[model samples]
Target: MNLKNYPRPFYAINQFCQPQCTELAGRSFYFDMDGGYDYELKVLTGDTCEWNIAGEEPKKAVYECLKGDDTTYMFDFDIVGAEPRQNFFFCIDLEQSLVTLVRCYIGRNPKFPLLVASEYDFGAIRVEGQPLPKKRHCLTGEMMGTTVEWHWNITMFTQHNYYSPAYYRITWPQYSSAEGSISPNFEVLAASDEISQYVKIKDKMYLYCLTEEMMERELGDSSPFRSNNMIFLQNYDRMYHVGRTFGSIMMDGKVVPCRTMFGSFGNPVRLEYNWLTAENPFTV
Candidate 1:
């Protein structure tokens, strides 16, 4: 099936649990911010669906009677807490079919500091050839103090596709370790036309950085050098072999293998890769 057409922001049908049984399964969502404010919850569900928000006194019912095969629930609310505080939580009941949850945070003013948030899906059933969705979460600490109004949007969905390889380019500024100085790394700068393609299946997504060399190779230059700089990556799930390199090239005409470093300063060279397609094998 065309998994691309399925709901992507909420949950995909084949990538996560299938809605085939009657169970009170749900996910926990959390949002944290630095400013003090108030908020509200908005929920919509398919026919015969039920749900509730945590910490809401009187146990207010977000949705009780959903009517339809596909239902969408949206929660928009303010956050009221002291500086460096968190606020938000909810649970959903899916009897059949998949449920999509779209949660957004609207700050009361422009003073909301880095809004941190996350969501947990409770009692999710395991399926084959599919990966469990990544917990929806974000944490942007005090580095981004509350000064400007902002909105945080999180979406979850489920879907499935064949295993494919992808590529990525990580660029950093150039630095002089001996001199203890920093400068822009011209060699690692991306071209204006560089674009990235994301292959997403369910909660897993592989990001591919399309470089000029890769484009040239794909267009028909059967050169060994082109194959040496290409790599593939798998970015979702807990897989160690998420990426593979085509080796490395020398900055002054020598050849060397690429090494992974935690910091990105002084690195004059960047990496590239070849993403697998339905018609092409990763090794090619």
Candidate 2:
């Protein structure tokens, strides 16, 4: 695909993503979240899943999963016909028997403008006759004030700047003088709309999440990202990431709740000035 001038704002990116993943199709797992909510999920082939919270009737919807290095998988799906639109994302580690769940919701209340707000929690995978892992993923600052260049697709390139403990910035790509127009895109994010969430699972393995709340508030239709949660688990040592994204996106011809997975590899980005360590530039 000639991905020139691909437009969807950065918020609803899907230009050069990996093919849909099916590694988790036909798999079933029960999750016991520490937050007291339990769920049973059955992933079917062909973009559909049947899942339910404990004691609730099963609901089916389209789903997507992306497999990453060393038995890590990312999957997401929405609750069809749900009020306010609730989408579920999972970062599962089969080797560790651990799981992380992110509940991304479309809170489009005019008063709140909650386009895509999420609540995160950690849990254990339930397997018959197997004990859950005693250890769980924890919050960390290992990637604080660092930068990595991620290639989302063939021609889509971007940078992730861990600008602050609470914020991360994305640098969009401009033309590369050396490669000319045939090359991909890469660069730093703007100073605004850097709010972020981070979690560490092991040495050099972490999770990063950011939403388009501020971007929609600032740029509306022009922002590269839209009302979605871009959540990914990155292994810095391996320079690879698997992510689950969910929100309303323009499909066919209309906007609908969507879930998807993507995988990519990246390397440490060399920067002249570190956003994490540099003086506050956005402060007025």
Candidate 3:
């Protein structure tokens, strides 16, 4: 497969298994993030694809049908199911040159849930194509080993089994959905417990600090991040999340502070004790 033809990094490209989607439906692909999927489609079809997950925005892939001298083709897209090997069905009518959604579903993958389990509050931001805020300044990070440019991207609140009635109804009906959203305002710098540390990306330097008070409120029993009766601490100190939330960009000897929060995001997940939560969701 041509790597440039795809929008983002992908795992495998197998023969299209869905029985109905026949016109040029050559492969089934898997990607960890929506941004990757969107990037892939945009490069292939030259149209912005929109697949809506968790009611956020339609960020799914789109296909454009083509008619040639002797063949009809549908824009190639991935077929996702409850598992990698399973074949979920979708159809494309050859005569009409229009693809029909016969049957489709997205399977569960553990990578995201595992990577994001503890740091659930770390929102994913897509920075590549977006413009920064007016007063916001860019910073680079230098840990004395490597100097890296840190850019602000899109911010997304990660969660598992986020509500999508139609999506869950077909993919994995047995699993229950769990939701929570408590993020730390500031991050902690644990580089040798020094009161403050300065990291530079080229000429830009960032000063860091820490905070206290991890909420003691009880999270629902069904919280996906909770494991072994302890809630996954959504610490903002994770290097990536901290770089966006707390680090102050230094320019011309003046410190430019970042925001405690960015964009108009939904309200933080409210934590309540004895929440009578449901059982954990089983991955498809």
Candidate 4:
């Protein structure tokens, strides 16, 4: 499996279980966010163990294991029924300090193993007097001892469908001042064989088409184009809209809209559009 696609770093190791093996014993895993802050631990099972820390509290199935030792243990938070794409965090309470860990897991699969361990030594621990220091990803073992950076890229997945509903008003520019506004009506006569055409609307020319799901994902959850856009040729339920600008059209390229206009739900829809040109003067 590609590790890049997954949100968290996943590693599977089948090693021999040990006696003081916190990994095999199923002890509640504790994550310390900062060097001076309080620590927290969640009991993976109902095994009771006592260790020194700071302030502790039980918050909604999560127990805070306060500040003390910087150690990592195995833990499983019952997150099987959680909603997808939601972000949340966990806090551990140690008597001397407090630690917090931010986490996000999409989809219904929730069995996660946390790897928490740190090498740095913070200042002396305090009692009920001061607030716990803020948690850091370094303690959560997310950092790999290297400078962190990120890059962004946008790629065209495919062209989905096109539609010019009756509600939408289409207009074109006139060549000269003498000619006025021109409005060309369009109606679907027949669809040609799925011939991959290299259409040049203006200057740009596209080689491939995008899948319907990719279109909606780009648009986001609440898109105005959803529902009332053009319908897919093969699947009428799937709606699509044309994405074209004067620059793109004049550059010699085809304007293939996203199929996400059909709305958000289960499966994504598919659609197609064909141009209707005039004989004498160029019109579509």
Candidate 5:
């Protein structure tokens, strides 16, 4: 997968099982969100997309699709002609007929304008005559305290710990040492405490978001691994995840887009509750 290079220091990973999607090609879908927003997504044979908003402008953009689990298709694309530049990511679950969207923005916000801001929404997928699914993906707590080491490029090995609901820790030790994983071999710096959020999709499936803005602030422009905004679906049943990233960094005195899609496997290790914090998210 010769996807474009991302910001320096973050070639997250790829799962050994997940692959670019071929199954959702030529499939069409309709989804309605909470605030009267909706979309009609048409997936072409080659993964090209021509999507339109219900009451907004339309665009034809080629999309990147990856088959994560058996029924989940992780799809996303740039909004072809929108000013300020935008990207939309969707996790379409066939079995549940559910749809979740994450709309990412460039430097468009009025406040903290340089941050890669995003908005999330979930709704039911409308099939021709089938009733819509009632169970939309919602916030989750199950992953709290669970540690998983995710495989990335050889030099990008890292582990994540959902130490609490609002904060997470990223370490560069190579493995979670779970039953089927290798023991840790090296140590990357303990990531500065960061925020992580999760949403349950199915019995063992979830959507996770991670941002490094806090760390980005500390590292300043001197750091090689700078801006990051990650959102991915974690399929525990298959031990793999597929998701997208869209954030910018100041490179050589210019802001550059560092966005991408990736899939990687994780080894989950269970730990006692006493090992993690008991406080709520973002409470300090």
Candidate 6:
């Protein structure tokens, strides 16, 4: 691939969903911004020139980034995920002289945020690993006089209650099994990334500051619990081992306030994992 074409936008990004099944065929991609190049780097497209996957020995064809308008661009391509339990990593050199390669993860259902490159002027961005696909659990709230909604990855559940931990596992359901076998994606999430918060009022635990949705849909009705867009945050006493504090998501760029069940008292705090004082299992 040649390097001197395209406008120079401060940043570039490539986003895609990890494959949920096997035998998928596709290419995972990403873009670069101020990291290099002289032009504004508006976008890459088939007309400008085709993109070739750097690693494939024969240089296979990949998707093109078509300029949608003055402010946007789009690309269409299929990304294949490794067999259920595996993952893939693809990389590109941002600064040829520095020998530094920027990488992205290819796996099942990873949620990523959009970024403006200028904000990260000097810092670099990289995806450490692929995120596991979560079993979507619905949580609803109201904002701007309208009902807002989002999902929680169900961590644990029981006959009498359900649990959505601040961080947890996401499992994939097998299609061929008679009883429906499942396998874990093995990706763990943190409270900060999940935008989750917990609260204790009248000794009961309630989660607040969750992502909101604009519409609702029925997924299934066969589970032991209701599959409707609602979830039960198990009482504090039922899962005290989980933690004393709650995890909450941010709204409109601010942390949603936590309140007592009666709405009289509100507790607003940032929930984070203490890596220093807590146990050390993994070193980043």
lDDT of 1: 0.24
- lDDT of each residue in 44-146, candidate 3, tens digit only: 2343233332334434444433222122222323333323221111122233222212121112225321111111111122334544222211112232222
Report backbone clashes per prediction: 28, 11, 21, 44, 3, 22
The candidate scoring highest on TM-score is 5
- Cα lDDT tens digits for candidate 1, 113-188: 1222222222221233545333322211211111111011112211112222232222221221211111122222
Error of 3 at 10 (Å): 35
Ranking by TM-score: 5, 2, 4, 1, 6, 3
Best by lDDT: 2
Cα-based lDDT for every prediction? 0.24, 0.70, 0.22, 0.23, 0.69, 0.21
Per-residue lDDT over 120-162 for candidate 2, one digit per residue giving the tens place of the 0 to 100 score: 8999998889887778887677778678887765555666678
Tell how far residue 148 is off in model 6, in angstroms. 12
Model 3 residue-pair collision total: 21
State the weakest 10-residue window (summed lDDT) of model 2: 178-187
Worst 10 residues of 1 by lDDT: 144-153
Model 1, residue 46: distance off in Å is 48
Global fold similarity of model 6 (TM-score): 0.19
Model 6 clash count equals 22
Which 10 consecutive residues of model 4 have the lowest summed lDDT?
A: 242-251
> Candidates 3 and 4: which is better by TM-score?
4
Q: Is candidate 4 or candidate 5 better by lDDT?
A: 5
TM-score, one value per model: 0.21, 0.79, 0.16, 0.22, 0.80, 0.19
